[model samples]
Target: MQMSNRIKEIIEVILNSKGYVTIGEIAKQINVSDRTVYREIPEVTEIMREYGVQLNTVSKKGMAAVGSLEDMKSLRISLGMEKQIYIVDPRERIDFILLYLLQQDDYIKTEALAIDHHTSVPTVRNDLKKVKEQLGVYDLHLIQKKGEGILLTGSEIEKNALMINILLNHADEATLYQWLRREGDVSNPFTKRMEEYGYLDVMSACYLRMKNIIRDQCELPAMIKDREYLEYILLIAMMIGCHQKGQPYEKVFETENFKGEEQRVTRQVKRELEEEFHILLSQEEEQYIKWVLHMGMIQDTSSVYTVKNRILDSKIHTFIEYVEDRMGLQLIRDKELKESLYVHIERALTRIRSGMCISNPLIEDVKKDYEELFGIIREGADRIFQDDFFPDDEIGYLVLYFAVSLDKVMKRSFRILVVCSGGMGSSKMLAHRVEQEIPEICVSKEVSLVGFGQENLDEYDLILSTIPLYIDKRNYLKVSPLLSSNELEQIHEAIKRHKYKTMRKITVREQERRQLESRDNIESLETLRLLMDTGLRVIRQFRIVETREKDLKNNLLRILSEESLCSLPETEEKMKKQQSYYIPVTDMVYYEAVLARMPEPKLFAAHYHDDQYLSNGEKYTDVIYAVYPDQASEYEKNILNRMLESVIEDRDIQEMIHRADEKGVRQWFGYQFKQYLAELLAV
Candidate 1:
C-alpha cells in the first residue's frame, strides 16, 4: 500500500527527532490541523505494523517510532523516502503523470494515478489538463476512452523528444553525469522517477558504448569538454536503445544529400552503434544523428564564418537590423554579439526544423528584467521567420545577447586592484573570480602586501585585499582568497557605497564650477584653449574617402602615409604582429577602428562610400585609425573615448560622419569637441 505524502512526512519527522514528536508539532510541520493528524494516526499505525515497526504514543509527549533501525530503514525505502524527499507539489505531480503515461503501453485508470500520487481524483484530473497542453506542443495527444482509461499517442520520435526535454528540465548537468556514469543517487527524486519510467534501463544499455565512441573521436573531445554535451550523448543513447527495441524513428528525410566532416563522423558513429546494438538503422535515424552531431560542433567551434548557410545568415542579419531599428541602438557593430547570435540562432533553427524543442531555464528571469526588450525581439523574430516555431524560450535566449550588448555600451567599468598575501597563483585565482562574478569590474592590477605599501592606492577605484589591513577599514575590504558568497555580497555593498560617494563628490564639484563660471570669462577661455590644443590635433588628422580595396592593412598604410603620422614600415610591422588592433565596429554602417602607439597622439579616420567585405568576412564602409604616444595624457584618452561614444550613442552624428566630406568631417568634429568641453566643465 502506497502511503500519502502527509503520512510520509509525519513518519520522517518521528524517525529524525531525538525524542518523541507531539501531534501539534507534526500538524504544524506539515501544515495540517491537529484533528486531521489524529484522524490519520490509525492508518499510519497500520502501515508501520506491516514493516515490523510500531508507532508508539506517550501520554503527553505525542508519538515516536519504536523499532529496530533496520525496520525503520525498510519502512523509509518502502515509502520512497530512503534517498529522496517525497514532494507533493502540483507541478511535480503533473510531471510524474506525464512520465507515467508515456512509459505505459496501455490505458491506465484515473483512479490509479490518484492512488499513486495519494491525492484526490479531482486533483489528478486538473493535473491531466496541464499534461495534455504540454503534450500538444509535440503533436502528441492524451486520449481518454470510456470505461478503459487514458493513454499517450504519438510518433515514437516525438515521444522520445518530449522525454528528453522533461529529463533535462528536471535534472542538472552534474546529476545527469552521475546518472550516466552509473553512480547516481538512488534517493534523488528525478533519478527515482526515471527508474520508474524505465529510462535508466535504456541509458544503461547504451551509455558505455556511446561514451567510448564519442571519446575516440578527435573532433568530439573538445565538444564533450562542456557538461552540456552529456545531454546530447544521453539523448543519442536513448535513441539507439529505442531503435534496438524495434521502435525506430519513422520520419523520413533525405540522408544521401548530406556532406562535410560532420556527415563523415556521423556515418562512423552509425556503423559502430549498429554493430554494437545488433540493430539495422533507418535512413531517418542516420540523418537525425547527423543533425545532433552538427549542433554539437556548432556549440564547440567559435568561428562560424567559414560554415555558411545563406538563407539562415540572411534571416539573422535581418533580425539584427530589425532590433537595431526598434531600439535605436547600434548592435550590428558589436562583433561578439553578431557572431554569438548567429551560432545560437543557427542551432535554434535546426532544432525547430527537426521538430525538437529548446528549453531556457532562465526564461522567466529574462522576461522579468528585460520585459520590453524581450517583447520587441519576439515580434521581430516572429516577423522575420514568418512562423510560429520561435517560442518564448528561444526568444528569451536572444534577449540575453542584446541585453549584454546594451550593458557593454552603457556600463561604466570600475578599475580594481587586488592585494593578496598568498602567492601569485592564489592572487590570480581571486582576480579571475572577481571578474567572473562582477562583469562591470576590471582587475587592473594585482600586488602583494609588500608591493601594496609602496604603490599609490588612489589610482584604483576599489582595492580588494585578501588579508586584514593596518590602515582604515573604510579604505579597503577584507575578503577570503576563495571569495565565498558572503564575501561577494560584502564587495557588492562596498561598490554601491563607493558609487554613491563618488556621485556626491561630483555634485559638489559641479556646484563650485558653476559659481566660478558666473564670476568671470577666465575659466571659459581656459576650456576653449584646452579643446583647441588637443582636440583640434585629432580632428585635423581625420580623413574620409571612397575606396574599393578590401585589405584593411593596405588601406591603413595609404591613409597613414598621406597624413605622415608614423613610419610606414613600423606601422606595417605592428599591423602584422597584432591583427587584434583592427576592431570591426558594425556591418549596418560598415566601419572599423584601429589603435596603435606612435611618437605623438594622432587620429586618422576614413569614411569609405563604397561597401566591401574585409579579409575577416565583415563588410565595412568606414575606418577610424588612431595612434597614441606611450605617455599620452588622460585628457587625450578621454577625447578618443568621447568620439567613439558619440558614434555609438548619437544617430545623427553617425550619419553626419558617414555623409560628410573631408572638410565637413573636420567641422563636425570641432563642433562635437566644443560640446564635449562644455559637458566636461559641467561635470
Candidate 2:
C-alpha cells in the first residue's frame, strides 16, 4: 500500500484514459526515466489491486484498468484521492459531516470533528451551521445537548436514512456489493474503508450471517429476493441486536395480526439475531421486519377492505391507466393487481410523510429486469405527485405489482416431464424443487431413466432429464440431481422456449398475421412490441441443453425459427440474393444468432448458441433464432439495425443485452443505446 508518488500518478493517468497506454508513453508523460517507469510497474500493479482495480495488459498493446465505472469511482474513495478527483466537494463534505453528527449517540465535540476532517475549528463550526440547513431537507434538526458538545437529533428511521444516504452517496453499487463480499474477511482492503464509513465489523458481519442462515434454514418468498434490501433490513436487525434493560411503555404490535408466514419470518429472524448478534429483538425491531416486508407479507387479499384502501381509489386508477398506455398492457382492469398496488402506495406514502425512508435492495435488479415498466411508473408517479419525486423503492413496489399482474395474464404455462436417475429419493427431491421454485412450469410426471423410455415423451412439451438420453429431441434439458442456480436458469430458458413457440404458433395464425400486416403506420416502439406478438423475443439466458454428437446448431436454429423471428432458410436465401451487406456477428458460444441486418430486412435475429462446434466452431444449444421482420419504420430499422451490427463487435453490447432492464435491452440495438452505453461502460 506504500506506493511512490510517481506510481500513484501512473495509476491516475491509466485510470483516466479509456484506451491502453504504452510504458514509454507513460514515462514520457510523467517525465520519468524508462528504468524508473519499469521499476514502478510492479508497485503500480500492487496499488491497483489494493484499491479494487484490475489492471488489464494486452501484452504489446500496453495497460489500462479493466472494471466497471462503479469500481473506478470506488477506487477514488479507496485511495483517499476523493478530494483530488473532485469525487466529493466541500458542500458534499458538509452533508457527510451532518450524517456523522446524526449517528452520534452523545454530543460529538466540534473540535474533534474539525480534527478528523483536517479543517480548522471555525470551519467545522461553519460546517455545523450548513449541516443544520441540510438536515432541514430531511425534516431533522441539530441540537446542543445540555452538558454535552453538539448533538444531532432525528427520528430513528430518519437518522438511519441519513446514514444510508451518506453511505450510498460515497459508495457505488459495486462498492456496496463488495462491502457484503468483504464481510468477515479482516484482511480485505475494503474493511478499513467500511469501518471508516461507520459500520462495525461484528455488526456488518452479523447482517450477512443472518442472510445465509435464513436461506438455508427457511424458505423465503420470491418477492424477498433483493440482496441489498435484505442487508438493509438486516442492518436494522443489527442495530436492534443488543441486550435490552427494560420493557416498552406501550405495546403497539398486535401479535394476532401476523399471519402464519409473518410469524415464521419474525420468529426465525428473532432467534438468529439473539444467537448471532447477541441482541433479543425488541417488539419495535420485530415490527421493523414486518414493515420492511409488507410487500411480501400480505398473504391473503380475501379480506374485504374494513378500512378504505390506504391510497386514494381515484389516484390509483389514474396511475393504472397511465401504466397501461405506456406499457401497452391492461392493468387497470385487474382487480387483484389494483388492490395490491393500492395497499403498497398507501403504506409507502404514510412512511414517506413520517420521514421514514425504506431502501429497496432489489431496485437495481428490478430496474435491470423491468426497465421500461419502471420508467413508465416513475413518469406516472411524477405526474400524480407534482410536489415530490417518488423514491425508487416505491417505484420498485409498483414494478412488482405490474410484473406479477402481467405475467398472470401474459404467461402460458407448459407441462414438463422430470426424468431422473433410478434413485427415487433424488428424483423426487428434484421434482419437489421444480414444483416449489418454478411456479410457471408444471411437472406432469416423474419418471426414472428406465421408465422414461417406456413413457410417451411427446405428451410433455419439455423434458428435463438427469442422465443422457439416446433420443434426439428439441425441448429437452439435462440437469444435475441437486438442481442448483445453473439448473434453475436452464429450466427457466426451457420454459421460455415452449412459451415463445406457443406464442409464435398463435401469432402467425393466418388470421392474426393478416390483421397485423394491415396496420402500416405503427410507431417504432409499437413495431418492437409487434415482434413480441410475432414471438421474436430471445430467451433471456441460454442454457447448454444439447447432447454431445448431436447437431446442436441445427436444433438451436429450429428453436429460434419456432419464435418466428426469422427463418434460417429465409436468411440464407436472402444472403444469396442480396448484392452486398455487412457480415454477420456471433460470439460462437452464447451468441448463435445471425446479426447482419439489411436496410429493410425481414426480421432481426435472436437465437441461442448450441453446445456443438461445426467446422467453423459454432453450435446451436436449444432454440433457433430467426426473425420474420414486419414493416418497421426507418427509425426502427436504423436503430436496431445498428445494434445488430454493434452486438457482434462489442462485449458490453452482449452483456448489457443480458443485464440491462427491458427498455435498456431493446434500446441497445439502436444508435441511442451505444451513446448511453459508452458513458456508463467506463465506470
Q: Tell me the tens digit of each residue's lDDT in model 2 across 1-683.
A: 67667877887767655367888988888998878888888888887776567888898899977665466667766655555222135655675576567657788887788776677899888888877755655657788665568987755556656666555554555445555555211222223344665465554566576666456644454435454454455345335522332322122333454457767766776677667656556676676565555534433445534354434667788888887755545667789887787667766765665455555546668998776667667878999866655677778878888888767655434667888778777677778888889775567788888888798765765677778876643236777767889779767765664454433333223223333455564643375464433223222322223233244344544544454478878544433222112222223233223323433333223333334344554343222222323444433343343344344434344454333234544454444344523422222
Off by over 4 Å in 2: 1-3, 10-95, 105-115, 118-139, 144-150, 168-174, 180-198, 217-221, 241-258, 295-315, 321-347, 353-355, 359-683
TM-score of each: 0.52, 0.41
Clashes of each: 4, 25
Off by over 4 Å in 1: 1-85, 145-149, 224-228, 254-259, 299-303, 325-330, 410-439, 443-683
Candidate 1 yields a Cα-based lDDT of 0.69
Query: What is the RMSD of candidate 2?
Result: 16.6
502-611 in candidate 1: lDDT tens per residue? Answer: 33333333433444456467876765576468887788866665565556667767666666666778666544222322322333232333345554556555566677
Cα error, residue 143 of model 2, in Å, equals: 3.5
User: How many clashes would you count in candidate 2?
Assistant: 25
